[model samples]
Target: MKRIFFTLIVSVSLLFLTSSAESIDNLYLIGVVKKISHNKVTVNVKSNVCRGKKDFNISPHIKIKLEEGDFIRFQINSSTCKEKNLKILKIMKIHKPRMEK
Candidate 1:
């Protein structure tokens, strides 16, 4: 029947739209390093949507050595990155801007 065919087409379109939307947004977080251990690092979140301190797992391949006072920003859910809530995409030390004359 034409009604059954039309319903099938609409369902398929909705499925495709939902999947595409989910893949478009990637999550990221920026925070200040509060503590650093051998296998994990704790960060005080500085984003508008998220707050408080969270601990993230340290990946073996991560090149940056974190100190307690370092401020950092990193991305999550990357292909090569693992861990549930902690993946370091990029990191750097906190800096103060100097005045230019």
Candidate 2:
């Protein structure tokens, strides 16, 4: 009886863990450079973050280089928020790198 119960618990736990892991899929977003002032910025992303809202303050080290009216495609690999503010874990600069002679 003990062996059977232990096996059942383990199996159930495994199932839950697998299901949760599967649900945690990576999310992506494409943003347009709305404005860049000082070291801070705001972007307009479609299909991501706050119902595709405009003028969302970006977190630091997001690897974005964009000018006003320039579009930038980016994504947040992982994030954590405090008081509804997001902190980017992994980011990439979608713009092409400048050539060096």
Candidate 3:
């Protein structure tokens, strides 16, 4: 009886762990540039944070060249307020490097 109970407990724990891991979204996220303003930004992402509202604010710590259609890499802080959204860590612009003559 003890052996069976131990097995059942381990199985339940493993199931819990797997479900939690699967539901967790990545901390690092990518989004498309939607709008930009001095010290303010908005991006469109597919994260659950969207919850049907895709636009989110980029934190003041965000470092990126403000431009429409650029992709941004950022991290989300669970403890941060909703108005600030997340921090943009990098920018990926779909452009060729300027030619140097």
Across 1-101, the per-residue lDDT of candidate 2 in tens digits comes to 99999999999999999998877333456665666776555666654343344444456655555576554555443432112444333445455435579
lDDT of 1 by residue, 1-101 (tens): 99999999999999999998777344467778888878788888786655677777766777876777566776644432233665554554453334579
Descending-TM-score candidate ranking: 1, 2, 3
Deviation in angstroms for 4 in model 3? 42
**Considering lDDT, where higher is better, how would the candidates rank from best to worst?**
1, 3, 2
Q: What is the lDDT of residue 45 in candidate 3?
A: 63
- Greater TM-score among 1 and 3 belongs to 1
Worst 10 residues of 3 by lDDT: 89-98
TM-score of each: 0.55, 0.45, 0.43
For model 2, where is the 10-residue window of minimal lDDT?
79-88
Task: Give candidate 2's total backbone clashes.
Answer: 0
lDDT string for model 3 (19-88, tens) is 9877734355556667777655666664565422244445566454567766555565442325444544
Q: Between 1 and 2, whose lDDT is larger?
A: 1
lDDT of each: 0.67, 0.55, 0.57
Superposed Cα deviation of residue 16, candidate 3 (Å)? 24
After superposition, which runs of candidate 3 have C-alpha atoms over 4 Å from their true positions? 1-26, 48-62, 79-101
RMSD of each: 6.7, 6.2, 7.2
- Please say which candidate is ahead in TM-score: 1 or 2: 1
> How well does candidate 1 match the true structure, expressed as C-alpha RMSD?
6.7
